[model samples]
Target: MEEAEDDLALLVWGQAEQRAAHGDPSFVRGLAAQLAGRHAAALEQARDYERQLAHVIRILALTPGRDSLTQLLRLLEDTPPAGTHPGLRTSFIASLLAEHQLVPDLVATVFDRREWEKLDELRACLFHELLLRGADTGTRGPLRDWTHVRPGWHPLAWLPAHRRDFEADARFPSRSVRGSASGVSSQLPATGRLDPPTPRPSQPSALRDVATVDVHETIVAAPQAGGWGACGAWVFLLDHALTPEQVPALLPTLPMACVAGLGPTDRFEVAARPMDEIWHLLFETASMGGSHTAGVHGAYGRLWAWRSMAGLSGAPADAGAAEVEQQARQSTWFHFEADAEWFHNDIGSDYGIAALSPDRRRIAVLAATDTD
Candidate 1:
């Protein structure tokens, strides 16, 4: 009974704070949670708050979807003290994390080591929460490996090639100075401008290599793309413009299918999870998994170490760290074919967490903006 009073007290205080300034969402959110816990007693207050929240939401509805998220973030920032409830602060910050598609500048604040450990998880957790609430990122493809079949020093050749159709939104182009933003063709949209689609490439390339790769969804990754462009680990950093020749000194050792192309602009997303999350994914996979495991291995070590070595420096790995990182990144090479419309949420997955516009039926590669 006493606990009920305490919870109600917290809710009242939170509700009061919410009224003072709709700016600090933390307080209101904290109150909402507290009220939810004391559902029977806090009925009146909860309804009042919900009505208020819904009302303000109407105002927010006026903004663009992504913009509304930004406004919420700004509202939180403007409130020096979001409120007394730590839960409230979590709720406010969480809104910003899930609502915005890819706010590079705002998210950069997450790296603030001093406050990072505390705020970092709120983002990941909330993303999943949003998913539970039916926030669909849109399916793109199956989570698996690509088999690379090629006779060359390039390691990426070992991975499988995505069928040209993998990019339904992309078109094949000859003499493309640079790949399109969607990475296949820029002049054409994904739906393929139907004037009797463009002719197949005259390059006479044998695409038999497309069969080697795959996906292993036995375990799961986060729902939305979080880091730079997905594949949100050091492999992302090593991506700073590697050459076809240089790809091997840093990539897989197996006989490759073929190396297509990788540039400096790639990205990925990963949790700042305890060193353990990395450890588990590295140490616990099935026997076929080259060097990655998932449970105890991750529990007892630091996962980022392997990425630093195998990724950035292109040096050989330490005793176990090297193998673990490599396998974790590469193990999912098993093929699980599906349509882009079904896997848009997992697009750029080879790289990291990305939210592809499943409805984006067209694509156009932007002209080179960086001459360097």
Candidate 2:
């Protein structure tokens, strides 16, 4: 039986490779379509195998000398804009870019045009991959073009100028904190004002350098695990619906939080942190479990012990600290440092939280307002 199973796997892999080469969309779409419903472990194993095949195809296609970057970019732009198999093609292009270390050019081009589109997040993830791989590489040349585009307001426009600030926030510590073997029940630090304002990062001079009086600066929320970490098990509250074009603006606000829409996660236990956040947001939408009104009575039910609400405000004095804590757990305010866009292109609606149910429908969001 073991031998039979191994033979079956090889047979399937061969067919997939054939389909991938023919620019068939079904094979890739099928994998992406299965992403949300399956158990986490199984899904990850499948993606790893798929990535291996993708890399093999990319390496084989590279020409000896003529600008490989140009070839890769043409491959990306050539993908069908709207279709069932678009992801497969786009992901194929993304994999090629990542494999060849073309991130700097990718980022520079995106901002140079301020071209926000359906795959902006994928590009952001690519930029993130570049960030992780190119830590030692200098930013002067790669990002120089990006700075001249918007100077301010464009997300990461200040990246060239504020390279250090971007670097400091993006770097997550590797030290692990004590938690469940699953890493699910780890206790996160309480969300409260950090005493002594997080020192403001040096602003770029407008005259001598590109600077926006509107530059946003805030201390990153305490590291999830403290050494170097990404956003985990946290809730985001938004006032309105988001669109694809708005994603880059929103991403900078979440400089520390890594989500499925932004990029992949390095953690072994999770496929991508954003997926978990989306699932919980979906669960919240379905259960309406996280919504609450102002005051003590609204703090009903047990909150997830591990997660912290960041922007919740306005509690009555008589409500005991425990009650306020409970309230926060339910409808804590989330403070976004900047405006946002729809996280991913697949999202269906803006009415409530932008997530899909187990069946892939739009999920609900907390109705509590800024004052609540």
Candidate 3:
């Protein structure tokens, strides 16, 4: 089956075996473009059968629903498809699938006979309306501050759910509020000062600026005026498991090939144009090392990917409001770049070399690095 033929067609799979190894859809446009006469008619007929019943029946037959364990039990109650024998299937799920968020896990563990015996003493707590009785805990904190009907206005019978607004001299006799036996003139305990509110604490304008996500990272000192159009991060291989705090230092190396991201595809969009020679260096670097070995020091082989960004230049809000409108043509993706090439900020092992154009023109250099 084409579905089961997990051959070498996947790039991830192929490269994975090497490093050990190395390494949408869109609809077609134009009605006339797709309608190719007789072939189109034949396709339409076949699709019509599929859109009606053929595809549905095929899917139903194959699933009978066993792609997942939950579905396996349901299907086995009858007798079904090609994937598993019910007995072994049950054991397999009990081992692997039960650990995650599956309901069967709770059913097997928490409700086991031992657990049931422990909770048996609480039988009276179950199957009953839990009417909480006694002095109200309402006088505590926010509950006391919460505005409610002035107390003693009505009989306690008015506590029924739908019973609203106590009547004056009807539900119960109203007493004087200026001086009542229930400490009417006495104020409830003051939880907080109400003095014109402490002139609201000042905001951290400094931190707010950092909190604002500009999505801007200066890729190089190439000086394209507003900023660089793209940026990426790469880790320089960890000799050991690094903690979260140690991560930002290595984020600056992500190359263009990290991933192509969301939205519509454009023939015009590309990580490297023919003129971008930096791309050549990236491709050569990625391909040269089939399997990773010692990078002089043991520190070199542990490198892993972080994240990448590309597509569309942004303009300063103060100066280029007009130019920002042209950026609608840009897009980015993660994991794989579809039809794009890979490249880093430079070629070779120079710690702080500059990025170059395809012709080797010095467009930008590592002016500085921003860790966070």
Candidate 4:
């Protein structure tokens, strides 16, 4: 593992040097400023570093080796050799570390440094990298097992991604750049459209009844092409009947007035007794204000979700949603959001805690801006 990690580090450093040679010198300077605790200068150089950091993260993510884990942890430690390393390289190493499921470990590192709140940008960069990789950030999911002892919100942790999606909605233009808000399309709306259908709350209700619920379910993500464009969707399959006890865990923090049925294919309706209650219980919170519902996602509709996160810098990841869903099965999912770029044209992006059962059978998908 040590040898492999050394080789991995060399590969990353080599790439960084190559990038630095061709890229702006300010990027490297930004790293030095950050290391020296020069916030203003670091912020000024953020854009230059953004591209380089993103590049390193992608390369490291694709590089296969369990040794990367050891190196990642080592980089977090403020040891002698690492202390002597250049700030740019250190930041790049940190970005690589963010590519995996190590939130608890990373947070612990921050705490150990006694710089919990000071490393907001570092944590932000890591969180953003996790999003780019489609990696489950151990912030709010079942894997998240920390208590909040701080005064304000979770320090250094951003709000839930789904909540950020809604906040971003208020900034988006009602109509998309290519289509109307009504989901009109030149081709078949089912197959393609600029705007796709999204689920919404059927009615409003009280808040006390709304709470996070968990249901375990399988979600299959596949590449989808439609008249609108290319995107993806989660084809969820329930193993057994959903119980009322497991409904709220899957829903958002909004009120649910009705129940809906969603299948693997693009067929959704007001689900029958147990299923309707199950979906309603899970999605009602999410449906209160956002475009969350148990609606069938069309190939075009998936594009809307894709657009929601279009501002995300790195290339779209090929990580399996099914794998993420499996992780949700092992961990818990709750409602959460994050800060995002100001895009007035975003459709939707699913970013939040999933309410999944302990067995991973019932899943409440609290989507960000898009629905799948």
Candidate 5:
């Protein structure tokens, strides 16, 4: 009998998914409410076993709500699922809470239930998802609060201090580039001439005396994970301040170690780009990793990119994103364009961005390609 009931629940879930896919939002919502009510009834009768719990989870994912989320978290705490990978379990729960816009509530519940100690995996996953979502939507109030109360190391602990850089509106005034295939032009001059403008007079004359520095020595550290695909950063110090036009000339001088798997730098067509485009790429890369995997590396990728740029620019370790943007604005920026096939063994999807520090003492280049 229980087998038949589980089968029926699965059938209902399939139908609900179909309804949702077919644009029948009203039907899906109505069915979700009905199922939630049944789940609530089961809870009141003290018969809310695993089967019912699974059924409601499916329904709530389709139509997430605060009450449903609280109930699910409480049930999981009371009767943890056996034989489930904690990362997978918590990642799914985090998605539901993020969808329901209940992240703050989840944080409060963690505090109320003292789940941080008992459910460390869930806590880490939830906080990381919050950071990814914050980057996506530019919402930081919850993140600010989380940092103050967050226990132990978090993937995005630097966010609160650097919040100003991630502000989508102010820092990225031009939405022209996001979500458009041609947002960033791939065209480069046939001669590869960058045609850089004269260095601004405001730049200090002292910058001319700075000595060349090794690219690797200036970066903080590369991300330890692989999902980011062919990632690397380099810093170039020069006797004269670096300019947008100077990037192509410096490309060949990059340590073979820096450009090895990325293919010859000559094949990459370069163009000047705004600061907004680079931030979009960083945020998008982070979002992609988190969406595809059940790890904290996505947030790490974003943080590492920011930190690398900060380190090269001589910004204080705790400098906000806005301050970094301010520094970048006074410097030169460029984007490198190439076909994914241009990379070795035809690993498609390549992106590269470089910036000269406002002081012109350093040029930081960050590049990555996605295998997926």
Candidate 6:
């Protein structure tokens, strides 16, 4: 009986692969059902169970039908041990589903079933993938609403509040250029213009006098796209006011008195970036999920990071997004391309942004680097 079962498993997997390759949906659906039945039987008998279950999931991932997805979700919901992290179960399934041609249908079905919380990681992954892939008009409304209603701590919670800005950025041709170590010139808006730096403060503030902001708490609370990384924010009180052209020259001056050293400045090619572009960069970076983890803060991390930067620059803590963005716009913003060496483990992700506050008296540098 064991030998026969093994033969059946091999036959099913071989046929499923062959049919899937040939675009034979009907055959694939039939095989998925067969595997689902085998999964149920294996569960009942407790023999060769895990292998049988993996077969079902593999076939179902390729099927793309609503029924197949439902079955897959049921397996995800019911099979894991009580203490198993939801992310462990959801990551594989989310990755498989993200590639399906019928993503809108799958998303609608998941929403209809009200499985958002139980499958929260899956839902977040789907949303992030959709955004990355450029959600079509039909998909945007529901996705926007999903962000609005999703719990505040959800990684994507920042989407609804900045929908207009995000949509505008999405329309820009440079939006697709992500964290390239070569620098962010390609990601800048078409204008490639920075508002002139705000006039220097009447009285220069001393570095020791600037209020201390807890940047580590703000940036580390969320999971970055490249996996585990280090975040550091510094406040610099400059004797001279900064110009857009001069911001890149300020990197080496940063006091590496702490553990998180300055990033790879020697390798970086820096360029002035508009405030909106920088905001978009922060959102994209924070919203990214690691290879084996979920994006904990999703879109929400942008606000968290922004607020911290604002506090470092002496903006009001309760300032709205517009006010904060305006403040950043008046500052000198620079984006550079280089491995974030401060992380110690480099996985080709290097994101660095520096801003000389509008007052030109204070400079805030925020950098995050990670490995997947």
Q: What is the alpha-carbon lDDT for the whole of candidate 6?
A: 0.52
**Full ranking by TM-score:** 6, 5, 2, 4, 1, 3
TM-scores, each model vs. reference: 0.22, 0.26, 0.16, 0.23, 0.54, 0.55
Q: For model 3, how does the per-residue alpha-carbon lDDT over 26-84 read when each residue is reduced to its tens digit? A: 11212223334435777777656544442232233233223343343334334432232
Model 5 Cα lDDT, one tens digit per residue, 268-371: 45666665555545544443332233222334445555655555465655577667556655766666654334233232245566677787767666665544
Best prediction by TM-score: 6
Summing lDDT over every window of 10 consecutive residues in candidate 4, give the lowest-scoring window.
214-223
lDDT of 3 at 339: 19
Alpha-carbon local distance difference test for all models: 0.27, 0.30, 0.22, 0.32, 0.49, 0.52
Q: Root-mean-square deviation of each candidate, in angstroms?
A: 22.0, 21.7, 29.5, 20.5, 15.6, 14.5
For 1-372, candidate 2 gives per-residue lDDT tens digits of 122445545645666577778898686455444443344767677677666544533543233233555454444455423333212344334433544444545555533343343344345334333443343324565344333433354332222233222123221112111211111112111342121122322232121111122110011111211111122222233444544333223322232222223222211111112323322332222212212211100001002111212111222334443453344333312212211222211122111122211222111111111111
C-alpha positional error of residue 116 in candidate 1 after TM-score superposition, expressed in Å: 13
Model 4's lDDT to the true fold? 0.32
* Clash count, candidate 6: 3
On lDDT, the leading prediction is 6
Candidate 1 lands at a TM-score of 0.22
| Off by more than 4 A, model 6 | 1-63, 76-96, 113-125, 136-149, 152-155, 161-213, 219-225, 238-241, 257-269, 275-331, 337-351, 368-372
Q: Tens digits of per-residue lDDT for model 4 on 24-60? A: 6665554444445544656657755655554443344
Per-residue CA lDDT of candidate 6, range 1-372, in tens?
222567667767677788788898787676667778878986666544544554456567657688888777777667642323322345444544655537667667665436534766566656655554556523456666666566777544433343334334421111111211121222323344332223312232234423254543443333333243555656667787766566654454355332123333234345677666666566445444343333433333344446544553446656665676667667767765442346433433445566778878776666665542
Location of the lowest summed lDDT over 10 successive residues in candidate 2: 293-302
lDDT of 3 at 289: 19
Candidate 4 residue 159 Cα shift, in angstroms, is 8.6
Worst 10 residues of 6 by lDDT: 171-180
